[model samples]
Target chain A: MRATLMYGAGDVRVETVPDPVLRAPTDAIVRTMRACVCGSDLHPYRSMHPSATGRPVGHELVAVVEEVGPEVRTVRVGDLVVVPFAYADNTCAFCREGLQTSCPHGGFYGNHEVGGLQAELARIPFADGSLAVVPDVDPASASDALLHSLLALSDVYLTGYHAAHVGAVGPRTTVAVVGDGAVGLSAVLASRRMGAERIILMGRHTDRTDLGRRWGATDVVAERGGEGVERVLELTGGEGAHVVLEAVGHMPAYEQSFGIVRPGGVISRVGVPQYESAPVGFGSLFGKNARLAGGPAPVRAYQDGAIADVLAGAIDPGLVFDTVLSLDDAAEAYRLMDSRASLKVSLRP
Target chain B: MRATLMYGAGDVRVETVPDPVLRAPTDAIVRTMRACVCGSDLHPYRSMHPSATGRPVGHELVAVVEEVGPEVRTVRVGDLVVVPFAYADNTCAFCREGLQTSCPHGGFYGNHEVGGLQAELARIPFADGSLAVVPDVDPASASDALLHSLLALSDVYLTGYHAAHVGAVGPRTTVAVVGDGAVGLSAVLASRRMGAERIILMGRHTDRTDLGRRWGATDVVAERGGEGVERVLELTGGEGAHVVLEAVGHMPAYEQSFGIVRPGGVISRVGVPQYESAPVGFGSLFGKNARLAGGPAPVRAYQDGAIADVLAGAIDPGLVFDTVLSLDDAAEAYRLMDSRASLKVSLRP
Candidate 1:
């Protein structure tokens, strides 16, 4: 099977790898039908995260089950499914509480023991809990746009939804999105779905800004730091935004998100932190009575609602995908995504 | 009028000060019947926070209204009241949103422009919002225990309640109260009122720990930092606490509160930061999917219920008072409070 692997920073290659097979009683192997480059992947590709030596690169995928372990009762061979980025037992107390991302028995599919999905075939663990069936949609009939939604359900879209939900975004709420990447763009859409009265996207790129605007950004602040926060405050009549989505995992973005939110507001973060530690302004947060909530999105928890919304055409979350390529060109997709030329790049396997 | 003033760190004196009069349209002059030293007061007394050359020393008080400005409608002269630490309009958008502490016109009584309650009289701005009527209770019949309730309502009790409420403490939830000061002890009581099944009080002082147990604390972790968090985690069967109340305003206490909360849980912080800034672990908070909330308590928002609870014996928040001194001994009370000899020191005028 052909899979994408990263040798080092800016080093991505498509090479033949051994096909994955069910290794655990709850595991299942799937023939990858779709995959995509994720913003998180760019973290290691840019050397911001520690590089993994010769490791598979993607975690988002829509695939057809090729094999299943005896314990996997819900999924069977040839069924089209969407796999979440994290594999959970779904029976744990945390998972039952809809915090599957923090499930005690859960692990990141790509970074931990299980191999990732930027390949012709991939193995999924805890199959009953991690895999979502695509009721009537055939793997071959799924459009590139629809497939992008599947990839999004694995992490980005659900993450954006989680950001909005955790921040308590709703009607009459003013939301500020802090990043211009795919997840941030998705947040703009999610905030709209959550009924935000005003949506502000803070970013610098024209293309990303346009995408954000299309996805329900009522305003955009191209400036960074104090100036950007000031603009958001001014737009919110000096009260700052009611909610802020910190989708860029960095000090500047995090600080900006905090600054632009009003006292007693919330900042929901979905950006994967590049460092082990970052100093948050506790004094500022304490004084403002603000809240900060985030983590890996509980994609498994939000899968049903997000899929329903996607299927209903109530939102076009797939608009985030700026390019689509063959799995053989997965290396190019990674490069384009890394270079920031594309918001999201989908791949067909 | 006699008042307690801090000339500098380690310097407190009882001296004659000018009597307060209505200073704003919403202001009211209150003749204090009772006042108390607060944990926050020690911040400036110990030089942890910069001390003004000559600043009045108290914000917690039970008083009789001496005068009211033309705009003061809810309170009038001759009424007994509990003055909340914060003065707010109660009609602003923030206040209407139940965030009186962040009201646009709100100001902390002691730190801002208004004279503080250690004085015989205080000019409380936004009187209608700051003063809660004592209702059927008479000042002559109010015991020292009830004085604790009054003083607690002025700041710590309501602050603790706000912390627990914002942290989403509820039935069956496990809570950890950090900083076993009056506020932390008050939080233990508040958590119980909110129906938290397991309450862990983190304190090093035996007296405070005992008081905490009396106030419904089910467990006590005397250690700080990693050990304290570890004990809390152990008590919760390794799942960590569902709600954490950070009542001590310092980096270490803040970190301890952050470390012990479970994923998807909340940390409510009512601690007034002593420094202009303090570091927060945003990455850790985001990864754990935890939440942080709180500020100055919206005392007026919960005053009715709290007073009712106190009067009905549903809770005895006043048990935290350890010493009672005449108003003339205010200086010594401040010193005792600063030296940690008393959990709370009540000053009767």
Candidate 2:
């Protein structure tokens, strides 16, 4: 089986690996149909030190259940499935509360336990709780666009939805989406679905922000830092946005979020924050009585609805995938995403 | 007239000052009946540097309107009123949204424009938007208990309510209060009012924690640092509290909040955070998908309901004021609160 592996910064490769087997009664072996690059993966791509043994890499995947352990009841062989990045039993107290990411028995793929989900075949733990079987959608006959959208459900799209949902976006909300990455663009679409009437996309990339505008962003601020904050304030009648979706985890993006969030607004960070400490005192969130929310998207909780929306053609989040390549080209996918040459790249196995 | 002044850390005094005059159409001259020392005041009492010209101090006040400028419509001369600590023209967009503390034209009483309300007579700006007139109480004959509760409404009580409200305490909530100050205890009371099923008060002072327990803290953890976090986790079946009310502004209090919050929980800080930055990265809030909320209480927004509850005898937040002193003893009031000899001290002018 071919698997995506990373040896060091700016280094990713597709190499032959032993096939995964059912390890637990709750496990399933998934034959990858589609997998994609995530913005978070770039964090390691830019700074991870070189290693001799290498590390398992990709997480987003729309796969088919090739085999299942006896206890795996929700998904079975030959069924198309959208597997969330984080695996949870869906019965733990935390999972019941929709915080599956923090479930004690939950874990993410791309780690040694489950293996990188981008491989031809990968072990899935807690299969019954983690993956949603696509009803009536045949993997072999599904359109590439539908497959890409389902693959997005595995992470990015729902992550964007998580930002808007946690931020409490509503018809009265004026949303500001920081970072025009695939997640940010998806947030614009999400805020729109949640009924936000105004959305400002803060990004310097004209091409990417154009899509954000098309999706639902009424305004685009191409500035960064103080200037970007000023632009967003200008767009929202000098009061700033009611909800600021911070899709870029860098300090600058966070600074812009606190700067342009309304006095009682929420700043939701879906992008994995790059650094630890930041101002949360009178100089930032406290002064404004603002809220800071969002983290790893509880994708498993939203999977059922997202797949329905995708299948119903009510949403087209797959447009975020600007490029596609064979699984053997995972290296190129990583490179293209890192260099900003592609909004997002989905790989077919 | 005499006003309370802070010359520096550990140096507060009651000194003669010129009588206040109505400064604007929105201003009202208030004859201070009760003004209290707050935990936040202790922040500067411990750090403010000495100066020849001291800063005017106290903010919380229940007073009678001595005189009102032409445009002060909501309050009338000789009317008893509970003036919120931060004065605001409630008609503004921020005020209308119930975020009066962020109202652009609003300012606290101790600032240069208003003089200290812990004086014989103080000027209140935005009288119509900043004060809630007592429906039937006469300042000249009001009971000490009633006056004390109304004074609490100016800041501490509502500050506590703000923490619980922003934390979204509900019937199913398990709350952990991280400070035993007046505001933290107030938060316990507020959480109970909001229907929280479990309330854990974290503090070392038995007297203070006793008051917290009376105010609806179902459990008390006297341990500090890691042990406090451990005790709180134990109380909540190892998952931590659903809402951690941070009533102390120090980093340690903030640290305790993140430590004891359950995944998908909220950590609301009502204390004026003394420091600027803290970890919001993967190791803290982000990892648990926790939320960080709260700031200065928008007392003006919750005035009506809080006042009604106090008057209705449904809550006794006035118990926070364990000591009382004459206006001439402002210096002593500050000392008692600073040394923890008094949970809170109200001054009668």
Highest TM-score against the true fold, candidate: 2
Per-residue lDDT over B24-101 for candidate 2, one digit per residue giving the tens place of the 0 to 100 score: 888888888898888998998999999789999888899888899999887888899998989889998889989999
DockQ of each: 0.53, 0.92
CA displacement after TM-score superposition, residue A133 of candidate 1 (Å): 0.9
Candidate 1 residue lDDT tens string, A1-349: 8988877777888888777877899999998887888888987887833465677778888889999999999988889888898889999999999999888888886643688788888888899998988777777778877877767887888889899988889999989999999899999999999889899999999998998898899999998988887888889899998899999888788779778889888888889866554434445676778877777888899887777777777877778888989988987897788778878898887
Model 2: per-residue Cα lDDT over A242-287, one tens digit each: 8999998999899989999999889999999999999899989999
Docking class of 2: high
For each candidate, the alpha-carbon lDDT, in order, equals: 0.83, 0.91
Best-fitting candidate, scored by DockQ: 2
